[model samples]
Target chain A: MTVAATSIGTPGDLVSATASDSALRRFLHGLPGVDQVGAEARVGNLATRSIKAEAKRWALDLAVRTIDLTTLEGADTPGKVRSLCAKAIQPDPDDRTCQSVAAVCVYPDLVAVASQALAGSGVAVASVATAFPSGRARLDVKLTDVAGAVEAGADEIDMVVDRGAFLAGRYGEVLDEIRQVKGACGPAHLKVILETGELATLDNVRRASWLAMAGGADFIKTSTGKVTPAATLPVALVMLEAVRDFADLTGTEVGVKVAGGIRSAKDALRYLVVVHETAGAEWLRPERFRFGASSLLNDVLMQRAKQRTGRYHSPDRVTID
Target chain B: MVRRPAARPVRGGERLEVRKTYKLYVGGAFPRSESGRSYEVLDGRGRLLANAARASRKDARDAVVAARKAGPAWSGATAYNRGQVLYRVAEVLEGRADQFAAEVATAEGLTAARARRAVEATVDRWVWYAGWADKFAQVGGSANPVAGPYFNFSVPEPTGVVAVLAPQGSSLLGLCSVLAPVMVGGNSCVVVASEARPLPAVTLAEVLATSDVPGGTVNVLTGRTAELAPVLADHLDVNGLDLTGVAGDAALAADLEARAAENTKRLHRAPGAEPDWTAAPDGPHRILTWCETKTVWHPVGT
Candidate 1:
């Protein structure tokens, strides 16, 4: 499927009706509250399902193809971005069959470098903008951030929502910002990051997910990788359920990108299991689900090598990016 | 007064002993075997002592992962800091001397006095190695008198993670003899405790846990040595293998040595048999065995 085709079309009546502050607040508040214990219990149970042999190999490959190989550090250099792009294109240099990752996520300033490096590699260049991890900036500056990245050849833009506004029950303001950023993205797909770690509750997570989708986000991301509780299983479970329900209501299949602290093949496979169980098998593709991670790629590659060699692999053999 | 007249016969007591359930130490936490397997540990007289976790190959794999995760900080710590941590472990071991002596007495069928002496020796062995942590480099490394205009020097560095097989005959002393040297060189290790006598080792694990030593620095796995040793020897991440515990089983030692070659791992081959761990001081051979000499050269006048 094409990347552009994944965008959720013009907001439906359900989204348009919640244009005002009270309407949006009431709409988000009226949604069902999450049962914390049940969500955690369900995730814990699903984590035990063993994906082995051929199924494991297939899962590993799918995980590789769905990764947003990301480097959003303040110290990222052109050399590092170029190297990350190279690793994304060929995760396992020793094996020719290993597929390239879906995209390379970087700071907006490095979008051009990543874009040029990944030009013909069938790997999209994703840039994080809108003051990125903080999301504490003027609206015009935020829009310019999005514009700069989109103009610099970013195929996808990851924008963080203002947590202060959202936490103060200013749902319409948050939605308005998301819509503006979505507009500024132009052709680049918009991934609205809720930064779920700071949201403080699963209820807030669900509300934020709906708010972002209503504002025309093509994807809803979990965190900014700077928070402590980024992209947890229960949080992801709540987001997945929201996406599934939103798709049911508006026929929009917004993707979910869980970033931060998702290292190890075991954790990735658990996430795949949760996705399959929470949001049907149709959302299993890269167009619907993604992992915004840095170290996760090496772990997936190591597991892949282990399966093929019938022996446990070591980190020494894999490239450290 | 009439009730007191009825004399109750004192026969069996109502209290029952809370037997300890020994679990494997990995990543600084105590977890039962992932396979949910446990084996009956017998005392010297072949009597049921307690149940120790029978670690599976997956447990060994987890230990390696933990060791690898904890490797960098351990190897990067200053030599003085490593020595202090090792000394802290010795301090904790000494504080729990009587408890270890009892466990050793039961596991190895030693008299209370002999077990106490062994525990003291083990604590002393830790202190002895702890003293070498900061000084081993000075002894094993040196300035080369090369016939050149450039100045050159060599320094000994830890060789990543090492896997140790604790001697089956002497539970506490032998385990310390092999484990202390490895850590003295800043190498984290996964120790497969003496399969037949693991009670003391598990008790020692508790000591290591309470001490200042980092978790995963010294993981203690109690299970069939035959089952866990091969897995560790074959692990590509394990940089060294000390086969001292498997000396009694020549065939197993030979097989482990062969597997260790897959990664060209430094192998401290098993002696002809389990040596007398109570013997007097040996040189720093065990510590140097797990160290890699890094040589640096510079022009004399730069």
Candidate 2:
């Protein structure tokens, strides 16, 4: 019934001490519960903050720079990946001042193609591994997924945690998997995907966020873009608070990425506001905050065009990725 | 007897009448103008009838967006289905004839009998265009005899989204006359209602919403034609421009036509003056104006 002394030690020490199931459970359960209604209300109030004029311009460009342009499909082709990489490098082909995106995210097999296409361009290459949207495979298979993507020159590895085990209260098993995957990542940054939609509650999202950070995650992503209710505001708020609190406890600034169903420039601006209010203005940078989206980049680009031209833009004006 | 006299009815002063707020109809919902501006709509006698949403350039932009989004589904629907939906609108309008008649009377400053006739003619005009939904292509398209062994045929297709200016004089009948043809051709439209007389058009929007016609298929904006027309004409997504309401203003019409050329939008040039809506439609020319001729060549053997 006592809270574990997780805040007293470094993240590495915390990981070593909570290596056992009972210890990890006591720490996660002992963490304060999320006030669901309060979190939702706070997010709702923050979403209405009218970011306009110069602030909107800054938010749009920041959104462009923080985007991880993604294309993960069963029928993905090299041509598609190459075009996406082209878009990532120069999102607005006509506007040379538009900044390039942060990264291009794809599947493991397509990493090399994206890596080759985006080479010498400042855009990094990210790949989803560890059984991606569904982490239902064995630990070895999951590690192999990570290893393949890393070998293919993925600058960042986005691996999904085993939600089944975590939901079954097997917190240590999930932590062990994350640590093993982190070790196999070699020199690449590791982003842990909690797929918060499957977590079912904000309390579980907070618990899973701490678990991923404890297991050596460089970033904690919200979803895999394959599930409904992905990357909602309340859920993102909870995860952002977790990372903020974790950074305070360990002096390490872990990043947060909210993927899936975020398509509009308005929604992206709201996310930037949430990050600024919940975490801090420092997390507004590309290194600490990223948007995992494909269509979102185009929307932000269109909004940028509207701002400049003082006229509305149509979908036909932008390149189709 | 004293109690009966005391209970004599108070006709209109018994309670406060609920006044309707006239808002722009965009994307199938009644929303206030994005600019939050409304202008007084006056009758012929200069009496303020109501305040209509003074649609700004942003509202026009939004209406075009809604029309563009609705273009594919509306144009892709079977011609028969479109006919049925348009007919359903007529049926609903028929049921609301008394309400529309009163609105038309006040908006156009016409006698009660004349307004009733206009409303009746408007409903009939809808039925007339609804009948053409399935027949316009047959009358306009043809299979040409080519010298080669290929069957070459030309058929009509809806020209994406069209921006319309409803006639400024005729409130109900003329608005329906122009709108029914564009819709009959399967092209969704963003209509700028008659600036000074927009009450009947707003009432028509209520009928369109309740009918089976899909949302975003027909967006109505009530504001200055000079303000909204240029935005629509210059819009890249709008495939056609109907300047019927600006017929009397040659300078504005010329300006709009020049802007329409920027995007190669099909231009339905305004006439010298607003035409009488009571007259029968002049064949299927109006319907064909908003359609593109798509020709196909098929090998004889295949």
Candidate 3:
């Protein structure tokens, strides 16, 4: 959707709004008290801008990943997956002359291979398991999958929360499911994926977020990167509010990961700022947050490298997935 | 005067001789460090006196709970009431000036005369920050320039828990310098007091307890700075850190900063004393720098 030159994304560009939509917007803008007309404009500006000066760097960190691996096994061969993961993980690991991108996400089964490849490396090992994309299997099967992945040495466990129950409004059950998966992870961190597209509305996504925190999920993520309507700012804002609300209650930091559809540096930065302004200044660490996009890695790496060398590497030049 | 009774000091560590035991001063009662562990501190002559706790990570966490539990009502207390509590602390310090002076002398490797000045400065420092409890907002707030008919002003608020590294040489005064600002601003502090002599700090905490300064407002840990500062910096609940003592050690400072970055605790790097803690007046910046910013909202014309 194309936004106007002025504040935030233009609603007209998104979809034609009925009178109800306008009323809700007015109510939201009218919050804290009646204010000048610029209230809506300021809120919109905040939606797009970083809350702090360091937020852009944090946003840049989430977009890129170097799949630190030598081999892989699957429909995508180990070598090819390693290259893909590297593409996902890199500006260039041995740029010996420079710095690079974020992390390299790989399959839980390939964790040993990837860990060996990325050993003595800065790029972290993030694995996708716990019946990712579809968390409808037996609970034991999910726990074993999580245990096996952590045993194989994954730094981050991106598990899919039980969407079936969440869609059915069994919020507690979905939260319990995440708790069980987290229990299986001895020391490995947990990132719960809500798969925003299937959650249907922003409110449910926000509800799912609170439930995930109650279940002890370390980070709440969007999408499995296998669906549409992946990472919208509005949904992200709802999750950010969830994080903000939860932190005030628990004093524990919760992370956010905007996966799928986030294919560029700009969108990634916007997500980072939403987190910063909502979660306060604490959730700006890699261990607490990350991006799970398959296509955003190369762009972030290229952009990060560009800021230094005064030269932009073409998509082909930077070998990120 | 809160007099120190002459008692035989036990071995803080397994190796020691006569060393004094500093009871945990909570709500005005003197008790031992809950962990039952202590380390001996020596004078300039290398003569050991008191056995202060080798406070564990658990103690720091416990201290945070105490501070937070005591926050709402204590902070919500009228600034004047809080000021009255703080003012009493100065009176207590003044009464025990000689004890503090001797400890400061041993800890900072300074003359008895210089130590007396330092100890006295701590009392004087309290009076300064105490008076600011109510007046800070008057000096540090402003109305925004917006096209609006409503009245608005942005003022500083407290950041809650502060992890302080009390200055090594400046001991009592510097400890007061950091802790007083934190409390006057309604922030509770977990302090790693000077390693050489921690007696004065425990004494100060006693004074605080009796002065109505409230429990958990200042938790003083006397152990190894190297061990405690990093742990405090990395603590999840710590909102900010005063790194004044670790400024001389670049590696330690860097380690504290990097670990503190995990929870993104605000690290006020040393050179903390540049603003003349002795002469500086209290302002909102001192207090608000340590407060939580809670922006509230309510629907208009609901």
User: Per model, how many backbone clashes are there?
Assistant: 0, 0, 21
Cand. 2 TM to true fold: 0.93
Summing lDDT over every window of 10 consecutive residues in candidate 2 chain B, give the lowest-scoring window.
B1-10
Q: Judged by DockQ cut-offs, is candidate 2 incorrect, acceptable, medium or high? A: acceptable
Over B66-185, each residue of candidate 1 has an lDDT whose tens digit, in order, gives 998888878888889988888888899999998998889999999999999999999889889989988999999999988899889999999999999999899999999999999989
Model 2 chain A lowest lDDT segment of ten = A1-10
Candidate 2 vs candidate 3, lDDT winner: 2
Q: Which residue window of length 10 is worst by lDDT in model 1 chain B?
A: B1-10
* Residue A44 C-alpha lDDT in model 2: 96
Instruction: Name the lDDT value of residue A57 in candidate 1.
Output: 96
User: Which residue pairs overlap in candidate 1's backbone?
Assistant: none
Tell me how candidate 1 scores on lDDT: 0.90
Q: Tens digit of lDDT per residue, candidate 3, span B176-275?
A: 8778878887777778887776777887777787777767677777778897786677665677898887756878888888977866777678663334
Tell me which of candidates 2 and 3 scores higher on DockQ.
Answer: 2
Scored by TM against the true chain B, the candidates give 0.94, 0.95, 0.83
Q: Sort by TM-score, best first: what order?
A: 2, 1, 3
Candidate 3 TM-score, C-alpha based: 0.44
Runs of candidate 2 with Cα error greater than 4 angstroms are A1-19, B1-15
DockQ of each: 0.52, 0.44, 0.01
Worst 10 residues of 1 chain A by lDDT: A1-10
lDDT of each: 0.90, 0.91, 0.67
